[model samples]
Target: MALDSYDLYVVIILVVAVAAYFAKNQFISKPESTGFLSNDSNGGTNSRNILETLQKNNKNALLVYGSQTGTAEDYSNKMSRELSSRFGLKTMVADFADYDWDNFGDIKDDILVFFILATYGEGEPTDNAIEFIEFLDNEADTLSSLRFTVFGLGNSTYEFYNAIGRKVDLKLEEKGAERFAEYGEGDDGKGTLDEDFLSWKDGVFDSLRNNLNFEEKELKYEPSLKIIERDELTTEDKQVSLGEPNKKYINTSVGTDLSKGPFDHTHPYLAPITKIKELFNSKERSCVHVEFDISDSNLKYSTGDHLAVWPQNSNENIEIFLKAFDLNDKKDNVIELKALDSTYHIPFPTPITYEAIIRHHLEISGPVSRQFFLSIAAFAPNEETKTKLTKIANDKSKYAEEITLKKYNIADALLYLSSGEPWTKVPFEFLIENIQHLTPRYYSISSSSMREKSNINITAVVESEIEKDKRIVSGVVTNLLKDIEINKNKSGDKPLVTYDLKGPRSKFENFKLPVHVRRSTFKLPSSSKTPIILVGPGTGVAPLRGFIRERITQLENDVNVGPSLLFYGCRNENEDYLYKDEWKEYSKKLGENFEIVTAFSRADPSKKVYVQHKILENSAKINEFINNGAIIYVCGDAAHMARDVQQAFIKIISNERKIDLEKAADLVRSLKVQNRYQEDVW
Candidate 1:
């Protein structure tokens, strides 16, 4: 109370020093705690417009995506939503396509960039994301101030699996961008994309909370669907919108690159199925002969080509899928799809019914993966069922025994594992989000383009098998073809069960099936009179048939036809040897120029023989044909028969020329390089 003025001043200085220290720590300091950095309201600027607002409010975020088929776009959207919903941060999903590097270096250091990249086509950049990748390769200095995280989607079967996403992660790190959380890669081949993504996003959110000093919010699924009911129509007519899409969007530009075109998983060309016939009377396997007419179309293909068939979801399976998703009542609801790329289109009738989506869009043929089992496990009706699902998801051996190895599709697997409780509680969006789109099945083009410019022929053995556990699995496209053939034979007397081969969208309706030409390297010699040898088994004789037809047509025009030798085989000659009548016509014109040797493994009980055995039997003539510069072609099973035939050729060359095995193998390799030895095997 009686203190002097000097004592009072000393007390004031101490108080001022404490206040300055507290203010500095609160405003300008970094926290020691590790996790998602808290949002710096002042530094996290997003775009130019966001930056102006940020100068007033705070910083913003950046959304980046490297999508293979638009899945990453969906994920990026999800991330943007989470950033806004949980952190109260302003966010916008940016396509890597539209991003520029001019001011990237000048961006605030606290700006968050989220990357959702999907690996594709042996780790090659996706068509839409390629431009962005090029920018990254050149603009290392621009990203030095940025903070980012990456999640890659990929299949493991490919050698360079997830290389695109992994490469981007490395490049970003090299450019001095700091990570928000550990950048991760998800394997779609193992079906861990969803789980891996879910776990990674949670870590990212946690990091954001701690590292950025942002407050955490509860995580919840925000419904993206808008449901509307039409009173004029039945209950099935109620439309559900996944997300609002631009209805007036036009598709005017057409893709020119046939090989890498948009004719794969997302969008498929509904090529016509022109001609189909049964090749065998009695066998475990059914040989399907089909010719697709491509004369009026701009599609061009060559011999030794493969036709890609865009298959439909079986009606029964579609119904099952609808029931599973609890969308059975609204099966006919119409919706349009919107994608960032022209190559990625809606995989159905444009603005089509929901039934069309179930029937033609989703891939319902394959076995369900464990990740799917885990995702839906929470929706299980009981605790016991949930535990079982969790176990299956965690244990590969159990999953194999109970799901994959058992070869169970979604419906059957759910029914069996869940004790037949109807799985109608799962959302339609979940199904659409999880299941992959149906892809086209490739068929070897059996007909030579030189012989029939208007028609492209294909030969396929309809695949069907019964699992050990008594589940019937049918090949999707082949069965679709068979059903189409049966309906055509009925002459419209009855309604089709699965399909009308000549469906409404099928433009080549006059022809039996939809087909497009695929260019390939398999072809006959350019010389009209060049001697040739053909070795094919089963329906593999398809292209060789085209070659023979070409020779016959040329001979009819008085062109010189050289010696033609064929070694064909099947289970039995009377059963599965294809094109019996056509071969007769070919023989008539070619005479000694045509040689047909048939090997029927089941025709004789004494011993079984194949085309390779037949070739060995006639080694002398084969050698003569080979020495005369004859082109050799082999078509069949690539994993076995083609390999066996190749080895047999080596043996023949070794013995005939009296050379060692190495020398004989070298000769074969040289012939292959020179195009004298060619193969078209599946």
Candidate 2:
């Protein structure tokens, strides 16, 4: 029997894993399928054998994660690394969705369990963790023998901050699970997620050491994988992957890997940009309306779903990183990496090139973590460079000023300190171990699934600004999107952003990019008769547009509709009012049933009118709608607008119902519990 290309790739990876496992202290090639590589990590028949696997591997700690966008999974892996290296505790990372709940309570008493969960949209569990949450909710086992700790990852901007994590903590306690340490919460809203985790882990370690009789060792550098450069095979070789994302995209001469496969985050569809146009009239900034042709792909999305755009790093940036590391000469040289330790998991496939690793796998743009800075300082070109890095790492005050305040990423920091010097002494494996993986950026789908089932639309405001240092700070995905809009429109003008439009091997030459659909809880009411009140400011109107478009389709089908009000806020109506003509068309179809209230803050009014002010102005009508079972939805900036809108609603309820502040708050909470007040805030 002959093996397919993907199968061959998998076998090669398995072989690497086995070889690495056998090497023990030596660096060898070993591969293990990681959760960060996909949307769902529970794929095989052995998924339910978590307990058996733990015992077989002699692991004492099992880190289970419920993640939507890989944050929790990444944290889980980090915990695994720390546990295995520093505490001398054998650990295994597992997806919550993989194990069966029926046997969840039967796990051995010797093993410690850790839950690193992220509360997603509207306080809902992630798609993969849904079944697990439900099982925990339904099962009646006491779980008396279970010992666990939980750390929640959530945005404080949402009403239910860390709701899933809170639920799990309470439920586990109720089921008699002993908690060794106080549970922690990491807030993404304040941009202190990493700092919060690092802080919490120290307390957790103290508790673990006290409870489990554990000893902490001095932190030392441990190499998990060894990198071997192959000079024989060049970039032109058939099997060489020059930044191709997956096995199906390897571009072998035998034939195309036309198999559609699963259109999940792991295996994305190369969706073509069917149509794109600038939405606003302003020239200084850009907000593009893009349409993707998904007819040939198996990616299905609802009206309020999100589209994950896999972006490519700029060629100039990749080159700068290569040169900084003194690897520009051997950019295409094939390298095989093998894990030296059984606990360490390879993030990506082995036998890839330096260019592919730098361009495709690693996140080269983000600001450096304090721990990462400490790790890389040891490999600095000179003692002076090392001293400077060590100073920044040791002095918390200086770190906040130099790294955080200045927003210096790895490349910028390295280039600034070691000017004209290549840090060639840094091991390739160390770089791979420290740098984070490049993940996809998600955008709200702005087109109705019904109006254009095969075509998905994305509305994004490009984030590009000239920093104080005269350096351009830009978003990777949004800049890529702007480039696509430029290519489609044939705008000969100087672009606000630029990109290497020709992707790996020109796979994305025709403005095609890898994409996948992520179903969101932010959706329109199932019934057309259900009234909806939408509050979306700026590009937050992305999902609201989809809702209104669906309502338009329903009206076209001659179905009865209810009151659908949209409160959209922007700086000015002339410069950035979005979908103006389309709203007018919708008004014609459903005369009194549809209305769009525009709040133009910069229309040169006597006062700056905002979305919350508009909501308050129509408080009487809003309260009436709420009394009549209307569903209220809020989107956009979660920190300010969403918070203000919620307060405005609370005030309306207080005045309308003639209740006290406490009672009004309870009423609002009830609405959220009933799913009447939903939010899709960022």
Q: Among these predicted structures, which one has the highest TM-score?
A: 2
Can you write out model 1's per-residue Cα lDDT over 258-334, one digit (the tens) per residue?
A: 22322322323444556667777764667678777665555666777777676666666666666555667777665
Per-candidate local distance difference test:
0.66, 0.81
- Prediction 1 global C-alpha lDDT: 0.66
Candidates in order, TM-scores: namely 0.64, 0.89
- Top candidate on lDDT is 2
Model 1 spans > 4 angstroms off: 1-274, 335-351, 466-471, 491-497, 500-514, 604-606, 618-628, 658-676
Which whole-number lDDT from 0 to 100 does residue 252 have in model 2? 48
Q: CA lDDT of 525 in candidate 2?
A: 75
Clashes of each: 26, 6
lDDT, model 1, position 327: 69
**Which pairs of residues collide in model 2?**
16-29, 16-30, 17-30, 17-31, 28-338, 29-338
